[model samples]
Target: MLDLTKLAQQMQGMSQQLTLEATATRQRLELAEKLLSHAFSRQNKLTTHQQTWHDRLSFTAAEPVEPLNLRIAIPVPPAAHTVIATDGSQIAPSHHEIAYCYLINVGRIILHYGQNRLPLLDSLPEVFYRPEDLYISRQWGIRTEEWMGFRRTVSEAVVLGELGERIKDEGGGMRDEKRQNRETRNQRVEAVASFHPSSPIPHPPPHPSSPIPHPSLAMVDGSLIHWFLEPLPGEARDRILPPVLAAWDQLRTNRIPLVGYVSASRSGEMVNFLRLQACPYDTPDCMTHCSNQGDRSPCQVLDPLKDAALWATQLEPGQRSPLWRSSARILDLYGDHRIYFCYVHVGTEVARIEFPAWVAEDADLLDAALSLTLAQVQKGYGYPVALAEAHNQAVVRGGDRARFFALLEQQMIRAGLRNVGTSYKEARKRGSIA
Candidate 1:
C-alpha cells in the first residue's frame, strides 16, 4: 500500500521542483519562438538548407508546402453538410481468460447539419477465435495484442469507407432521379405545345424540389501516417497496409474529404524542423559536425518541445497553421494517398489535423476539412461531437469484459466441455477461492 504521509511529503518537494522547471520551460519557449520567427524571415534560405541536408538531418522534419508561419482564420463552414466519424475499441486476447479470443468493436457516427433529422449512431462488434485470426506469421514475432490493435485500425478505416460509399451512392441516386424527372416533364410539355413554328415554347421551370448536395467530411480518431509499418518487413507490412489503402481509395473515389483528428497532440515534427533551423553548421550534419558538442549543440536549445505546444503560442482559437507534408518513411508506400497535416487551435488545446494529399490539393475539400472541423469543435465545446460520440459508442468497459468471459464459460459448459478454466492469478484476482 502507498504511504499517505510519505507521499504527501514527496508531493511537496515534487511541486517545488515542477515550479522551477516551469520557469525554465518558459524561457526556453521564448528562445524557440525567436528561432521560429528567424526561420520564417529567411524562408527561402531555410527551405534550401533543408533540401540540401535532407538525408543528413538527425531527425525527421516535415516538408513545408506553404510558408511555415502562415496562419489561416477558420472560415464559415457550409450551412448544410454531413460529418461522419469512426472510433474503435478492442478486448485483447489474454492468457488468463477462460477462452483465448479477442473482440473488436467499431462505432460509427453520422451527423447532418441543417437537415432537421435524427443522427445515425451504431456500432459493429465482431469476435475472433479462429487460429488464423489470432495469429500472424510466427516468424515475424508480432504479438497478438499488437496485431489486434492493427486489425482494429484497419476495421475502422474500412467502416469509414463503407459509410462514405453509402452516402455517395444515395446522393448519386437522388441526382439521377431528378435529372430523369426533369427530362420526362420537358418531353411531355414539348409534345403538347401548340405555337408558331418560329416562336419558342416555354419549358417547365427548373425543378425546385431537388435537394442541394451538401459537402461531406469523414473523420477518424488518429493519425493516417502508418508510421508503425516502417520497422516491419515488406511482406509483413504489405499484409496490413493494402486494406487501409483500399479504404482510403474508396473515400477518394467518392470525393469525400477524410481527416484524422488528434487532440492535444504531442507530435514534435515541427519542433524538430525548428531545431533544424537552429543548427549552426553550414551542412547541418549532426554526426560529422556536432557529435563532439553533445549537450552544447545549438539545436539542443529547443529540446523537449512539441509541435502542438509551439503552435499553440502562435495560433488563435479557430486558426490553423500552414500545411506540411509528413516525411515519414512509410509514406513513400502511400503513393497518391500521401499524408499531409496542419495544426489547429480548438479553443481548449492545439490539435493536429491530418488528411490525404488529395484533400489538401483541392480548394473546396480543404475548406470543408478546416471549416467543418472548427464547427465540430465549437459544437462539442473543444472536440468534435461526432468523434466524441463515436468513442462513446466504441468504449468497452470492465463490466462488459467480465460479462463476455462469463458468457463464454457458460456456453462452453453447455457444449459438454467442462474443462473451461482460468489461471490461478485471474481466479484469485476475482476473489474466487477455488
Candidate 2:
C-alpha cells in the first residue's frame, strides 16, 4: 500500500502553502499594477505636449523599406541638447530580445522598446483620449477591439506556462503535464512558421558561431551615442550597428559624458558575512589581530575597503606599503562602478550618485548635475542630504577650527555654492546632529 493517508496530508499541506504564496504574489502584483496605472495616468496628461514636439521633428522612412527594415531620422535642431540612454534585454517564452531607448531633454522623457520589425510608430496612440491603450500595447502587443480576444489568450498562456514550470519542479499534476504538452506542440508550429521563407513574419537570424562585424557610422557633430548591444554573432554586427547608430542619432543632440558610482559594500550584515568568508587563515596572526578579526573574518580579496582601513592603522605616513596608498586603490578593487560617486560615512546609508562625467571638474556644472540627480534620488529613493561641506577638504594642523572654516568657505565660493544652508537645516530637522 502506498501510504495513502500520509500522502494526502502532505499534499494538503503543500497545497495550502502554495495557495498562501499565490495570494501574497497576487497582492504584490496588484500593488505594482496600481503604481504603474498611476504613473501612466499622470504621463497621459503630458502626452499631448510631448506628441506636439515629436510631430515637429521630421522622421522620414528610408526609401523602399524592405521587410524587417525600419529607419527613422529625426533632425537635431541647432542649440538642441539632450541625454539619451539605451539598453536591451531578452523577453521570455518567445525568447525575443527587446531594446529600450530612452530620450531625455530639458525634463522631457520618452521611452521606446520593441522588435525592429514592429516599429514604434505603428503602435503609437492614434487618439489622444486613449492613452492607456499605449501602455497596454507596449506590455501585451494588443490594443482596442483586438485586445478583447488576445488578452485572455496571452494571460492564459502566461499563467499556464508558470503553472507548468511549478509542476515540473514539484513533480505533480496531470493538468500541468497536458498544458505543457499543448504548449510544446504550439511552439513547434510557431517555430516552423517563423523559419518558413514564404511567411511574412521576420525572425532574428540564427546564432552565428563567429563574432558579428559591427558597422561604423559617421558621428553627427553635437551629438552623443550610448549604445548597449545584445550579444550577437560576428556575422550580424554589420546589420545591427547601423540601426543602433541611427536610433542614437534620432534620440539625442549632445555628447554627454557617462559616469557611474562604486560602493564598497551594501548591508552591514552582508559585509560582515562576506568578511568572515574572505578571511585568509584560521590561525590568529599579528596583522589579523590588528584588523579586529574575531570569530568570523571577512574575505580580504573581496573586501578591499576593510583591508585599506586595516592597513591604514598599521602603516606609517609616507610608507611604501601598497595597501595604505590611495583611496582609489580601495575603490578600484571592490567598488560597484554603476554610479558616479559613492558617499561613504560610518553608520549611514550609502549614497550612490550617478551623473555625466563632463560636470565633474567644473564646480558650477557639478552643482547643477548634483541638484538634478539629488532631486531624482530624493523623489525615488527618499534620501536627504546631511551636510553641505566643501567637496575639497583642507587639513589644518593642531585642529585649527578657524583655518578649517576659512578654507571651507573659500572652496564653497569657488564651487559657486548654493543650497548649503537649506541642506544643513533639513539635516538638523531630521535629527542628524553631526
Candidate 3:
C-alpha cells in the first residue's frame, strides 16, 4: 500500500524541483523560438544541408515536404462523409492464472454525418490459448506481453481495413445505382429522339456525375510506424508487418484517407530537425562533434522541449503544421505507404496526425482527411468521435479480467481437466486473512 503521509512529505521537494524545471523550460522555449526563426530565414541552406546529412545523423529527424513555417487553416469537410476508426485492447497471458492464454478485442466505430445515418459500434474478440500463441519463439526469448501488444496492433489495423472495405462496398452500390439510372435515362432519350429526328438529345450534359459524393476516411488510434517491429528478428518482423502494409494498401488503392491520431504526443522528430539546423558544422554529424558534450552542446538548447511545445505557439486552434516525412526505419518496409505526419492544434492540445504518403501527396485528399478529423474532434469535444467510441468498446475493466479467469476455471472443470489451479499467491489474495 502507498503511504500518503510519506508521499505528502515528498511533494514539497518535488514541487520545488518542478518549479525550477519550469523556469528552465521557459528560457529554453524562448531560445528555441528564436532558433526556429533563424533557421527559416535561410530555408534553402537548411534544406540542402538536411538532404545531404539526414542519413548520417544518429537521431530521427523529420524531412520537410513543405516550407517549415507553413501553417494552414483547417478546411470544412463535406456535409456527407464517413469516418471509421479502430482500437484494440488485450489481456496478457499470466503465470498466476489457471491457463496460459490471452485475449485481443478490437473495437470498430463508423460514424456518418450530414446524412443522419446511425453510427455503427462493435468489437471483435479472439482468444489465444495454444502453446504457439503463448510463445513467440523460445530461441529469441521474446515475452508474451510484448508479442501480444504487437498482435493487438495488427488486429486494430486489420479491423480498420475491413471497415474501409465495407464503406467502399456501400459506396460502390450507390455508384452502381446512379450508373443504372443514367443509362436508363440515356436509352429513353434515344427512344424519344428516334420518333422526332429533328430534335437533338441536348449533348448529354458533359461530365454528368455530380462530385464524387464526399470522402470517406479510415482511422486507427496510434502510430502507424510499427516501431515495435524494429527490434524483432527478420523472421518475426516478416510475420508481423505484411498484414499492416496490406491494410494500408487497401485504403490507398481505394482512395480512402487513413490516419493515426496521437493526442498530446511527446515526440521530438521535428525538434531533432531543428537541432540539425543549430549544428555548427557545415556537414552535420552527431557522433563526431556532440558526442562528449551531452547537455553542453550548442544544439542541445532545445533538448528539454518536445515538438508539441514548439507548435503550440505557432498553430492556432483548427490549424495544422506542414507535412514531414517520418524518419522511422520501419517505414522503409512500408513501400508506397510510407507514413507522413503533421501537428494539428485541436483546441484541447496539439495532436500528431500520421497518414500514408499517398494521402500527404494529394491536395484534395489531405484537406478532406484533416477536415474530417477536425470535424470529429469538434463533435466529440476535443477528441475524434469515432476513435473515442471505439475506445469505449475496446476497454476491458479490472472486473472483466477477474471474471474471465473465473470463467476459464469453470470451463476447465467442466471439461474434466486435471491439475488445473491458480498460483498460491493468487489464492491467498482472494481468501480472507483478518
Candidate 4:
C-alpha cells in the first residue's frame, strides 16, 4: 500500500516546479517585450550601428534606411527569369541498424517564369552511399554530426551550375528540338506561341534584345557558411576546399547569382549593432569593459530582440535592407567570395538573404537577383515556391525511412545475409509491447 501523504507531497513539489518555470518564462517574455518597445521607440535615433560595431562584431548588418521607414517596397521582378533552388534531407546512422551507414537525399528544382504566369518545374533527386560520404575526419570527433547534409548542399549548387552550363551552351539540351529542324522551326515556334505562351521555352533563335538568361538566380535553402566548409584544426584545407570552390566557380562562370535564403532566422548581428549603439562614449570598447553575461550585460536591456524582431514591422512585403558583410570564421577563408547579407520581407516573415560580395558590387546582377527572389515570394504567396518544391522533393518522410530499411533488409536476405539483425530495442519500438 502506497502512502497517500507521500503522493500528495510529490504532487505539491511538481506543482511548485511548474510554477517556477512559468514565472521564469514570463520574466523572459517581459524582458523581450521591454527591449522591443525600446527598439521601436528609438528606431530613428539609433542610426550608425555599423560604424560603431563593425570592428568588434563577427558580422555586420544595417537597416536600408536610417529613420526606419515602413512604407518602402522593391520593384516587381523583370518580365522573365529563371530560379533554381536546392534543399537537403538526410537519414542519420541508426544504432538500430546492423550497418554503420547513413544517406543523404538531395532535391533540386529548376523554375523558369516571366511571360508565363505558371512556372515550369523540373525536379531531380540523388542519393549518396559511401564510407567517405557517411563520416567526416575524426579530428573534430563528431561522428553524429550530419556531414552528408553539407555534401548534398554542395552537390545541389552543382546541379544549378550544370543546368546553367547547359542553358549557356550554343547547341545544348536547352536548345529546342524543333529549333534544330531549321525547315519547320519557325512554324513550330508560332504554333507553340499560339497554343501555349508558356510552353515555348528552351529555344529561341535569339531574343530581340539582351536575353535574360534562365539561370539568373540560384537559391540555397540555408546559410552558405557552415562548419563543414570551414577550416578545422589539423584538417588540411586542401582536402575540403575544392568542391565548394568549384561549385562557386560554376555559378560565377555561368553568371548566375547565388542566394542563401534563411527563413525565420534569429541571428544576433542586429542585436550586436543595437548594443554597440547603446555603448557609452566614455568606454573605448564596451564588449570588453562591460563583459556581463546574459541579462546582466549592459546592453541586456535590449535582450532577445533579434534582427527579425526589430524589422518585422518596419519592412513591407518585398522590401529589403542594405547589404552587410559577414566576418564569420568560415567566411574569412572565402577569399573573393566573401558573403554579404540583407533582411528581406517575404510577407509571411522577415527572412535573412545572403549572397557573395560580387552580387552586391554589381548593380545589374543585384537587381536581377532581388527581382527573381521577390517574384518567387509573390508566386508562392509570401514564400518562394521553388524552395518549397525543392524541400518537398528532398524531405525524407517517416514512412519512407521505414520503407527504406525494409528494402535494405530484403536486399540483405536476397544476398544470403539474412542473419543480420536489429537491436531488440529497435524491434520493441517496432511492435514488441504494443
Query: Top model by lDDT, which number?
Result: 1
What TM-score, over all chains together, does every model reach? 0.88, 0.22, 0.89, 0.74
Off by over 4 Å in 2: 1-341, 344-351, 354-364, 381-434
**Model 2 lDDT tens row, 135-254:** 444443333333322232222222222222221221222224345664464554354334322343322322222111111011111111112122323333333344433332221112
lDDT of 3 by residue, 95-175 (tens): 888998999989988777775445678888899998888775554667888888878888888888777666565455445
Candidate closer to the true structure by lDDT (higher is better), 1 or 4: 1
lDDT (10s digit) by residue, model 1, range 1-434: 58998789889899999999888878878988998888888777777777788677777888788997789998899788888889999998999888899999999888878844346688889999999888764558888888888889889999998877655544453456467775464544343233222343233322322322778889998788877888888887888899998998888877788999998787888888787778877777888887788888888887777888888899998899999888887898999999999999888999999999999999878998899988998999888999999999998999988888888899999999977989989889879555
By lDDT, is 3 or 4 better? 3
Alpha carbon lDDT of each predicted model: 0.82, 0.27, 0.81, 0.64
- Please provide the root mean square deviation of candidate 4 (C-alpha atoms, Å): 7.0
Scored by Cα lDDT, where does model 4 land? Answer: 0.64
**lDDT minimum window of 10 residues, candidate 2:** 118-127
Taking the tens digit of each residue's C-alpha lDDT, what string does model 4 give over 178-209? 34665354554354334322244445533323
